[model samples]
Target chain A: MFQQAKLHWTQSLHLELFQNSTKWHTLYEESYMDTSRPATQTATQAPPQAQLDIDKLVDEHYDYLFGYALRYFRSRDQVEDLVQETFLAVIEAVKSFEGNSSPRTWMIGILRNKIIDRLRLKCREAEGESIGFEQDLLSHLFDSVEHWISNVGPRVWGSCPEGALKQKQFFSTLEACLGKLPEKMRQIFLLRELDGYERDEICKTLKLSSSNVGVILHRSRLALQHCLQVNWFEEKKARGPQ
Target chain B: MISCQRATELISKRMEEPLSLKEELSLKLHLFICEFCEKFAQQVHLVRSAIKNGSTEPDDSDTHASAEAKERLKDKLKLRS
Candidate 1:
C-alpha cells in the first residue's frame, strides 16, 4: 500500500511538470511569432541596415503615431497621409536621429513638428489670421491646465469588476458616442476628456469663452449619456427580461 | 433653501471638482430630505458610469483598410530609395 501511494505521488508530480513545460513552450512560441515579423517590408528593398532600422521603427510606431495625427487633424482619412508624411521626414532625417531618446519618442518628436507644419500650412490656406490666433490661445490655455492637473492626484473611477473585455466594450461605446457628436463639440470633448486639457485652455484654443466651453461640454456629456443609455443599458435590460 | 434646479446644477458641477464646504453641506442636506432628487442624482451617476465604461464595435470603415491602398503605400515607400 505504501509503495502504491508513493507511485501515485510520483505520477502527479510528473503530470504537473508536464503541464508547466507545455505552458512555457506555448509562451515561447507566442513571443517568437510576435517578434518574427520584419518591422517594415519597405526597408527590405533598401541596401543599408540603418535605413532598414529606421523603416522598422516607423512601422512599429505607426498606430499610436497615426492616433496622434488623427487627434490633431480630427479626420481618419487624413491620418494615412499624415503618417506617410511623417515617415518620409523620418527617412530623410534617419542619420540625425541621435539616439538621444527611445526610437518611439524620437519618431513622435518628428511627427509633432510635421503636425505643426501642417497646421501652419492650413492656417495660411484659411486666408485669415484666425487660425494663428486660435493656436496661440490654445497653447496658453493648455499650459494652464497642465500646471493645475499635473499636481492633482489621478482620478480613479470605480474598479471594473468585469475585466479587460468589459473595459474594452466601454471604450468602444465611448468612441462611438464621441464620433456622433457635432464637429466643434466633438473636438472640444476630445481636447478635454481624452487629452486632459483644462476648460480654460480649451476655450482659449477654440477661441471661445469659459461659459461656451462649459455649455459644449455639458451638452456633449448629456448626449453621450443619452446615447449609452439607449444603446447599451436599454438593450441589456430588454434582453435581461422583465 | 436652494431650488431643485439650482441644486441639480451644483450637483453636476460638484462631480467635476471638489465642491466648496457650503456647497457640500447643502447638497448633503438636500439629499437627506428629498428622495426624488436623491434618486435623480443616483441615476445621473449611473449614466455617467455607463458612458465612461461604454464600448462599441469598430465601424466597417475602420475594420478593413483598402488592401490596394496599403499595397500602394508600400510600393511608394519602396520606391523612395
Candidate 2:
C-alpha cells in the first residue's frame, strides 16, 4: 500500500480543480453520462478470494485516482462515479490480482478501463461534436496556400534542458497547456500520449474513424505545442533565457 | 510537393503510425529544406515526452481527496463489496 504522505502534488492540484471548476461540464454538456445510476449497479456479486485492504487502498489512492480521472473528465460527479466504479471492479477482481504490480497500478488499470467504457457509451450516443473550430485554428497557423505563417510558425525552443521533465514548474505549465485543449481533443491526446493506448484502440474505443482520430490528434499536438511555447518557453525567453 | 502544413501533419501522424512511402519521402524532403518544420517535429517530440512525465510522476502539491468525497466512495464500496 502506498503511503498517504508520499502522495502530494498531483492530488492537491486535482482537488483544487474539482472543487472550484464549473467549466468542466461545458465542454461535454450534451454527452456527460447519466451518472445518476446507482453506484451498486455495476458491482459484481462475486465473493472476494483475497484479503485486499480496501480501506487502506482508498486512503492512499482515492485522490490520485481522482486526479487521474480528472484528466479524462473534469466533472466532480463523473470523476467520483468513475473512481467508485473502479473500486467496485477492484473488489471483484481482487481474487485474480497476483500482486505482480502495485495496488495503485492495478487500480489505475481498472480505472482506465472504466473510462474507456464511459467513452464507448458516449460514442454510442453519436453526438458528433462540431469540430469546425479546428479548421479556423489551421487557417490561423497557415497561409492561404497551406504554408506556415511567419508570426505563428513553430519557433526554435532550443534544446530541452537537462532534467527538464523533473522540474515541477515545467509540469505545472504542461498541465495548464493541456487544460487549454478542447475536452475531446484532450481526451484523444492523453489516451495516446499518457495512457499509451494504441491509435487503433483509441479509434475503436472512441468510435472515431482512423482519419478523424488522426486529425484530432494532430490538432491537439498543434494546440499543446503553441500553448507550451507561449506559456512556458516564451516566458523563459522573456526572463532572459535559462 | 507537400506544403508546410502537410509536413507538420505528417510529423504528428508519424508519431501515431507509420506514414506511406510518398508521405515519408515528402516529409523528409520538406524537413530538409524547412527549418521551421524541423523545429516543429522536435517540439512535438518534446511535448509528448513532457506530458508523459508530467502526468505520471507524483509531485509535492499539498492536496488530497476531500473527506466528504472519500467518505462517499467508501460508503458506496461498502454497499457493493
Candidate 3:
C-alpha cells in the first residue's frame, strides 16, 4: 500500500494520491479528513449569528461538493481544501453567477477548475510526471480480430452482487483502484461516470477528440473492472471452499 | 461476425450515439457467443449504476469539510454580502 494510504482509511480513495514518499507535502496547506463530524452537522450547526440562508445553502450543497471532490482527489485534506475554496470562490462570484446552469452544477464547475489547477501543478512537478499510460495497454487485451485474448479475458463476477456495493469498503477499494489509473483516463472516467457528461461535452471540456474520449472511457472501464475483479470480487472466490 | 474487441467498442459507442442496424446486430451476435464479453458488459452496467447511487449517498468516510472551514467560508461570504 502507498504510504499515504497507510494511515487508517477514512473513506474511499483515501489519502494516497501520487505524491512521492521521499518528500514532505509542504507544497500546500496541511490537512486531513475529519469525518468525526459529519458535514451535514457542520452545515446545520452554523452558529445562531450566521445568516440563515447561507447556512441553508451550505447545509444543502456541502455534501454534494465534498462527494464530487473526493471522486477526483485521493487526499482528505485536498478534498477539504477544494470544497472550502469552492465556497469561498462562490461567495465572490455568486453575484455574477449567471443562473444559466443549476447552482450545484455551477459550484461543481468551479470545483473542477480547482482540481485541474492542482493536477496541472502536479504535471509540472518532475517526480510525479509519469502518468503510466501504456500505449499497448488495450492492444494486449484483444487479439488480431479484436477478440479478447482468451488467456487473459474477463471472468464472470458471479453475477456481481450489486447489493455488496453499499458497504463503504467497496468505495475504498474502488477509489484506490481508480487512483491507480493515469490522470487523464481518471478525469474522463469521472466526468462520464460521476458527472454523467456526454461525449460531446467531454470532448469540448477536455479538448479531446470524440473518438479519443470513447477509447479512453472504454479503456478506463476495463482497467477499473480488472482492478476490482482482482482486489474485491475475486477475493470472494478466493475464500470459496476454504 | 464482429470480434469481441469490435463488439465491445461498439457497445461503448452505443452509449455515445445510436448504432446502425448492421453495427448493432454485429455486436449482439458477438455478445451472444462471448460469455466473457457478456460478463464485461454486465460489469459496466453494474459500475455505472453503482456510481449513480454512490453519488447520492452521504459521506461514509472519516473525512469531510471541517466546521471551521465552513464557518470561515461563511464569514468571508458575509463580507461580500
Candidate 4:
C-alpha cells in the first residue's frame, strides 16, 4: 500500500512537471514570434539587397559567433551583446570589407580581435593580479572541459523520433555540450566547424598554429563524442529497458 | 590498426569533408577490420551530423539591440567613418 501511494505521488509530480514544461514551451514559442521580426528590422537597417545579404550572413554565421562569445564570456547575457557588437562592427566596417574571405571568415576575424580586446581590458582591470600566461589559461580551460565531458557522458543520436520535438531536444543537448567544452577549444571548434572557416584562416584569425587548431578541434570532438555517448545514449538505453 | 592519434586527425578532416576516395577506402578497410575504430568513426559521424543540423541560428532576441546601445555604437562608428 505504501508502495502504491509512493508511485501515485511520484506520477503526480511528473505530470505537474510535464504541464509546467509545456507551459514554458508555449511561452518560449510566443516570445520568439513576438520578438523575431522586430529584432531583425532594428538589428540590420541595410537596404533590401543589403538586408538580404546581412540576413544570409547572420543566418549562416550567428551561431558560431554566439557560441564563440559564450565560451569566452561564459555567460549567455553577454553572448548576445558580444554578437550584436560584432555584427554592428561588421556593418559599420562593411565598406571596407574587401571580399578577400567569406563573410563568415571576415566577421570572425573581426570577432577575434574584439574578444582579445575585451580580454585585455578585463586583464587590465584585474590589475596584473595574475590572470596567468596564455598557455596556463588554455590548460586550465581544457582541464575543466575534460572533467565536464567525463561527467556529462554520451549523447543520443537517431532519426528524429517526434519531428521538431527531437530536433529541439538535440539542439538543447548540443548547446549544453558546447557549454561544457573549454573556452579556447569551444571557440576553435565553433569557428572552424560551425562557421566553415578554413583551417589556415582559423589559425591566422585566432593567431594559432595549424597544429594547435588541429589539436584543439580533435580534443573538442572527442570530448563531445564522449559526452553524447555517455550522457544521452546510455541513459536512453537504460530507460528503454524499463 | 588506425591509431587513435591518426584517427583523430582523419576525423577532423572527415568532418570538414568526406575523405578522398583512397582515404575513404583506407578508413573503411580499417573499420571492417576493427570494431572499436568503427564505433569511433560512427560516433564522429554522429557528432558531425548533429553539429551540421544544429541550431547555429542566431537567437531571435538579437534581431534588435537596445535603442540606446545602437545609438552609442553608431555614434562611435561615425567618428571613425
Which candidate should be chosen as best, given lDDT against the real structure? 2
Best by TM-score: 2
The sequence of per-residue lDDT tens digits that candidate 3 reaches over residues B1-81 is: 767877777777776799999998888888888887887887777777666666443455544656776777667656665
Q: Which candidate tops DockQ?
A: 2
| lDDT of the structure predicted as candidate 3 | 0.63
User: In candidate 4, what are the lDDT values of residues A1-242, reduced to their tens digit?
Assistant: 22332233333332221121111112111212122343224222323333224433455456666655655566665766677777777666554333323455455556655665565455324432222433453353234423222233222344432232344554656567777776656666765665445777677755657776676677777667666566666666677732
CAPRI-style grade of the A/B interface in model 1: incorrect
* Candidate 3: tens digits of C-alpha lDDT, residues A13-33: 122221122111111133222
> If the candidates were sorted by their lDDT against the true structure, best first, what order would they fall in?
2, 3, 4, 1
Q: Write candidate 2's Cα lDDT for A64-145 as tens digits.
A: 8888878777677888888887787776665433332345655666777778777777664534452665877788889989
Alpha-carbon lDDT, every model: 0.49, 0.69, 0.63, 0.52
Q: What would the DockQ be for model 4? A: 0.17
Name the better of 2 and 4 by DockQ: 2
Which model, 1 or 2, shows the larger DockQ?
Answer: 2
Backbone clashes in model 2, listed as residue pairs: A9-B59, A9-B61, A12-B63
TM-scores for all predictions: 0.53, 0.78, 0.66, 0.51
Candidate 1 chain B minimal-lDDT segment of 10 residues: B51-60
